[model samples]
Target: MTSSDTSVGPSSDLSQNAENFNWLLSRFAGNTAGVRDAIAVSSDGLMIAQCIEGERADVDRLSAIVAGMTSLAGGVAGSYRLGTLNKVIVDMADGYLLISAIGCGSVMGVIASKQANLGQVAYEMTLFANRAGAALTPELIRELKNHIQV
Candidate 1:
């Protein structure tokens, strides 16, 4: 994972928050047994933060996938008169891709191995979202967008 360049932005608070977000995501992936990678993306598909063992291109691809999945799910929910789109789980042969809303117009995407405990990972994702959602304001998102790691 690429560290946020604190010196690149003007607001220390934003920088600190970005760092905190990165740390939180790192912990979520590290502490969870089945989790392989995770990312936090804005409503418009911008990557706010990521915690993955791959290159930047991987992060970008995940961001796009998350955005598309959420959009399609939301559409489905509306079409079927579902109250709200909560989560979308894609169970692949090797692993799973789970996308869930984290509030404040953002969503969290997690990739977990096939052997991972799905229930446990879902619980952890909820915890992480609740803790990080409030801090994901528009201003911080803008700052994060401007200085996201390449």
Candidate 2:
């Protein structure tokens, strides 16, 4: 995916931590031109927040897909005696899909156009995912428990 020229401001949530998440998303989006959408979702495929353009994609479905892919990759790695899953990239005709593990059970996903640079996108995603893991882990666990209870 090519780099995007657009820039988005940070989200105005009362929590400073949330604002940090927004900043990460904004920075990631701004740096990638082919990045049509990006989102932070729990490992169980629940969306925490998203920055999207044009028609709204089904975030839940996307998250679930990424989570499954991540799990599958992990399983494959395990069979080979590999430790953990780092990232998975799905190349399509029109664009590329990237997913990286954030923490214990969370993943960050990005959808970018075919012209986007995979190497740069991967690097930025790794950085963003690391920060997001630190910022989102507690909230995500609480939210996940609530969903489970419900």
Candidate 3:
């Protein structure tokens, strides 16, 4: 099977207690020009948080897609002896999807509109990812889960 078809592991049974994750995402999305949405997922592909409007089904599907893409990217990097992969960016005709590693076992995905400022958005995403990673510990996970509905 392709790397994208495979899952890595199980998500934490526990959830996060912090409600600020949404606020953080909102600030990120709102501050950036042409940001379509932003999502946070566990390393194993579970939807943790997002800054978008949709039903659970849509959010879950997007989470899975992000997780799958992340897995495939890491696998590809490893195969080429690229050491540890930091992020993955897929540029499309209509928009862009950028994924970056968070903490030890999570990912942050950002979707940008076609008119988005790629450079600034990318830089901000890096900073956002770093902050996310810093907050991905057990305690923070609980906060994240509590704050996000998905």
Tens-place lDDT per residue, model 3, 106-140, is 88888888998888888888877766667667667
Q: Report the Cα lDDT for candidate 1.
A: 0.81
lDDT of 2 at 73: 85
TM-score for each of the candidates: 0.87, 0.76, 0.79
lDDT of 2 by residue, 88-120 (tens): 899999999898887767777888889898998
Ranking under TM-score, best-scoring first?
Answer: 1, 3, 2
* Model 1 pairs whose backbones collide: none
lDDT measured at residue 134 in model 2 versus the true structure, 0 to 100: 72
The sequence of per-residue lDDT tens digits that candidate 1 reaches over residues 19-91 is 7776777788878998888888898988887777766778789999999999999889889999676778999
- Choose 2 or 3, whichever is better by TM-score: 3
lDDT of 3: 0.70
Number of the predicted model whose lDDT against the real structure is largest = 1
Off by over 4 Å in 2: 1-13, 54-57, 140-150
In order, candidate lDDTs are 0.81, 0.69, 0.70
